[model samples]
Target: INYYVITTFVFQSAIKLALFHTFWWMFSQNSHILFHEMMRKIKYARIAFGHVLFDDT
Candidate 1:
């Protein structure tokens, strides 16, 4: 029933959605590079440790 409360809620939702969209766009643009860099780090770590030192557990 309060217009101020409704307006504030809508504004916050819009801001959150905009931020998420921007982040997704940026990530999509550099996803391949990010994946490649991550893999490279993992490869080097394995080589240095002589095995997979990190585990899921």
Candidate 2:
């Protein structure tokens, strides 16, 4: 019984650590992609607004 409990505890802890690492890695990757997409949109918006302002002038 004691051995089984110890093994179970170790297995649970290992799975938790692995899940934590995977989630962290995924979060960082998603944030990086989102950041780049936001920048691209901002750049495009600026160019579009500039054209509109230029036409009005």
Candidate 3:
């Protein structure tokens, strides 16, 4: 009975850790993609602004 109880506890903890790792991996991947998209947009905006300023001059 004691062994059964210990095994169950260990199984539950292992499942929880796996789930946490999956969630964290997904979150990081999504954030990395978002950051890249934001950087691209900022770069484009800066180029456009520079062109406009040059045109004005």
Backbone clash count, each prediction separately: 0, 0, 0
Candidate 3 has an lDDT of 0.60
Each candidate's TM vs. the true structure? 0.50, 0.47, 0.48
- Candidate 2 Cα deviation (angstroms), residue 17: 0.6
Model 1, global lDDT: 0.57
lDDT of 3 at 37: 53
Writing each residue's lDDT as its tens digit, candidate 1 over 1-57 gives: 875586567656655665565566557768776666556655654463443233222
Index of the highest-TM-score prediction: 1
Model 3 regions more than 4 Å off: 30-57
Off by over 4 Å in 2: 30-57
Name the 10 consecutive residues with the lowest summed lDDT in model 3: 48-57
What overall lDDT goes with each candidate model? 0.57, 0.60, 0.60
Greater TM-score among 2 and 3 belongs to 3
Lowest lDDT block of 10, candidate 1: 48-57
- What lDDT does model 2 reach? 0.60
Candidate 2, residues 1-57, lDDT tens digits: the string is 575576557656655665565566557778776566556655765665466446533
